[model samples]
Target: MTVQYKFPDNFWWGSAASATQMEGAAHEGGKGENIWDHWYKREPNRFFDGVGPETTSDFYYRYKEDIQRMKEIGHNSFRFSISWARLIPGGEGEVNQEAVNFYNDVINELLKYDIEPFVNLYHFDMPKEQQDKGGFENRDVVALFAEYAKQCFDLFGDRVKMWFTFNEPIVPVEGGYLYDFHYPNIVDAQKAFQVAYHTMLASALAISHFRKLDIKGQIGIILNLTPSYPRSQHPADLKAAHRADLFFNRSFLDPAVLGEFPTELIELLKEYEHLPAYKEEDLTVIKENTVDILGVNYYQPRRVKAKDHVPNPDSPFMPDWFFDNYEMPGRKMNPYRGWEIYEKGIYDIMINLKNNYGNIPSFISENGMGVQDEHRFLKDGRIEDDYRINFIKGHLTWLHKAIEEGCHTKGYHLWTFMDNWSWMNAYKNRYGFYSVNLETQERTAKKSAYWFKEVAENNGF
Candidate 1:
């Protein structure tokens, strides 16, 4: 029996890309340096094969051709972020007219093809000046970000109807503060907590600004929600998984949608003396300005178990102090990205949002597989990425089930539109419908692109 899987009416069909990852001409068009630019200059060896953001996919010069390709692939919508440093060089002060013109042209081009533009404000490309001023650790940066948001609304709000305050807000905290992957790396739990808090507060402030502007559009935050699974039914294991969820997912999810931090998370932070220095006014802002929409980016599930060994009391406080990652036996895996493949995690996330977060309108903002040595899958001048096709189908099947069960999911956007430069990993893992030739900057559609075009045309598989 061939059972058709159909999405709801007006389900957005497209892919996402970030300015830092897509736009080349890193120093062109009167753009200011961002953390990526600074970090690459300081430690070029840190990035994969010494490839930095200086010359990514050249989206700055190729957006017109890219938009045309998007139209041909049946995309009714597209999502991309504006480079803060590029738009408002130095992260404050007067806007660069060239950057403004570039983005305006991109938005207009998307609209010309009947494609809705989902614009995101921030995507981990912090201005170097802001980073020097303590980045998110300093409360002043919050206001600065709000000002930038207001500028964006004033400039492009009429054409760009869907606005996102931040994409994966917790990622910077995790990568820059907890882990040492991102620039200005510091493994301080206290700083990480402060960064997370300020990001949530900044999101609220942006939402507040958006409402004041009276824009006829939806405003929201994009969160990468990883459903936590316990190793066993033991109380300790269950507690470990729950705490992991609180630390990673709900830390940003709660404030963005529900306008409050989880009680357990607050108590845990307080106990560890890791609570961020926040003013009463910031809390009020968060409480009053919940998101109008939610962008759920699910890539994997977190499997955790209770910590077996007590940490040294003198060591710095960390989320792993309460839980440890558990590797489930016989788990499906994406070896390239080194993440577990759990398709049902998408459905679980949707159900969680529906049941706990007022059933807020949401969408799969980023979901796709990254494969190393993708060229090996090429055949007859086209990449025969059947695995990628199956991956999307698996996740979409679960997403469709969630909708059947009454989850308010509005769309599904793959992690990216085309193969572009990643942060540190560079081009090691390809996760795009169309593969790009880094040497020539030419884009060739993969087998999955044709399959996805048909799926979008049919509204489902």
Candidate 2:
């Protein structure tokens, strides 16, 4: 077969899974309770099917087998997050020796298969103990996070070359402070801005620590960027999209890549009295410690339109106050996940980075189709997920174009490797190359896994 969309040589091909999402030893391995464990224990009904993080794919004990499977599937790199609580129980002093051995074994196993380990420091699993101290809201907790990051670097930086300070930093702010979907749920824009600010500050501090360590690796922060597209070229619609972009994308992107916050975002926050309380010294740290790389996770695009009505003065200041989500008529939709399937969004994001953010080194860190009841596509013994194969190909075609057009795009990693317990949604939406039997813990390779193997081996599809 002729290769049509060949990627650059040595491109990374694998998947990403967080500790809380895939490691079933949530309470074992000397692991301390994280906010997820605490939240699930308190509000089990809030999770789908009453499932919690403890029911993950058992990667904690099965990582050796998983690494072998990754080698078979032609993975050159795999991204995984180190459980903060597991490493240092309660996210504080007294490092767990057992946890250190487990991670060292994981890194060694991956290297044995010639797979690069892209380690992420945080993935929304704030230790319950730290949350008691107001989490990132307290500047001392921010210092604690930086200290945790330093420990991770000191422990794993020898083998792990790509380090991410945090994965999707804006997500905790949105889920916990704004929308109330995650743990410690609160709906105050004031606190939301504070969490966002503190999180960015934490990342900068981590990077500062990494540079001081003189580790022979690059460090970055992973951001889930959804390009904000306007409903039309009308100035009002454009303005709405701009605001959404400022609040969602640029809020984190500018700080990580450009070493500063967007001017408009700061001005808007000040206008609404929603600016986060911060020290002047923190700004200098953020400005001086920009990232060396960027990981872009694109699942969908945000279609925005101008707000149709004037906001009441009594209403709280929210992002929705300036814009409304526009459902573009006839937009391609992922029926299973209810997200837009705009493949071009990947290209658009890359171009935006190239034009605006210095074309920093980057990769598609997470992108895949998640379907509910994926067993509906099962044929014989395996899931015949042609939809997933098409989804990846569509995105990669655009990613290839981006690379060809002078964007420094490096690789593509799916959202996951096997069916695992997701937060709140649980296993309702399966986004994996292998469909895992939750009852038996059996991982059956889906059709996409084989197709992905060939694509990875050939450097294209």
Candidate 3:
């Protein structure tokens, strides 16, 4: 077999998973209710197939076998997020020893197989009690989050060197406050911006504590960076793209990596009287505690065009006020979930970091194709998911080009290792190298899994 795109030595290769998404002990193991757990219980009809996060993949009881499978597939690194609700139930109180024991076992097990564990502090799983206290909207809750982060650092920092403070911090804001997809489902721009600000502040504070504690490992945050492309070269279209980028990508990227908010974003917020409440001294904390590394999760690109209609001043303030989504004619898309499949988006992101964001060391924290009704593709007890293999290869080719062009790209991790229950959608879109049987919990390798095994073992394909 010809290896046309060889990767650098020791390039990380595996997949990423979250505690709420995969680990299924939502009620047991002293794991209190996260927002997801509470939301699903309250509004069961909101979730697909009326399913909840009670038992998704059952990693709580089966992580040992899963770690073994990761080793079998030649995984050098794996990323999993810690459940804040589980670790410190109610978000701030006595630490749950059972939860601590479980995570310690999982980390130690991965190390036993020579698999490096990349642990994330939070992944949108705010404890229900904290949400009652206003979640990230309140600055006092922000301090509690840092304390929770410090507990994690002290508990597992020795073995888990690669620590991520938050995985896609902007997601909770967009989902919970701006949109109605997540818990505490409100639709207030003011609250959304406040949540976003507090989340970043919490991340910086955690980084400060990590440095002050002299943790002998790197700390970073995973941001889902969607490169906003203009529909045309027209000035209006370019402006729309720029605004979308400012709102989505740079909002979190600049503050996490550069330690400051974008001036333009601040001006826009001020114009609308929607600036989030913040103290003057918090900006200095953000400036001094930038991340040591970055995790870039690229799933697709955002194409925007100038709003076709004149704005109505009476309308509620929203990011959409500046631009409208442009569905590029003839763009490739994954029909399963109607998500655009733009491989070059990964390269564009890496080069942007190279040119604009100091080429900070980064990796593809999560990228993979999810297919619905994956069982239909099963042949002889294995899914012949050539589409997923092609999806990964296409993105890797672009990523390879970015590395050659001097981008500080490091590694790639798929969205998941196995078919885990997704949020709200439950298990509708399967994005995994291994197709898991929900009934028997049997893990069957899809075609892409074997293809990826060779790639990881050979350093490329």
Candidate 1, residues 1-461: lDDT per residue as tens digits?
13399899899999999999999989999999999999999999999999999989999999999999999998999999999999999999999999999999999999999999999999999999999999999989889999999999999998889999999988899899998889788999899999999999988999999999999999999999999999999999999999999999989898888889999999999988888899888889999999999998988999999999999999878899999999999999988889999999999999999999999999999999999999998899999999999999999999999999999999999988999899899999999999999999999999999988998899988
Candidate 1, overall lDDT? 0.94
Rate residue 343 of model 3 by lDDT: 99
lDDT of 3 by residue, 1-461 (tens): 47999998889999999999899989999999999998998999999999899999999999999999999998999999999999998998899999999999999999999999999999989999999999999998999999999999999988889999999988888899888888898999999999999999999999999999898999999999999999999999999999999999999999998989999999999998999988999999999999989999998899999999877888668899999999999999999989999999999999999998899999999999889999999899899999999999999999999999998888999999999998889999999999888889889989888899999989988
- lDDT against the true structure, each candidate: 0.94, 0.94, 0.94
Candidate 2 regions with alpha-carbon error over 4 angstroms: none
**Clashes (N, CA, C under 3 Å) per candidate:** 0, 0, 0
What's the residue-level lDDT of 226 in candidate 1?
A: 93
For model 3 the TM-score comes to 0.99
Candidate 2 lDDT for residue 257: 93
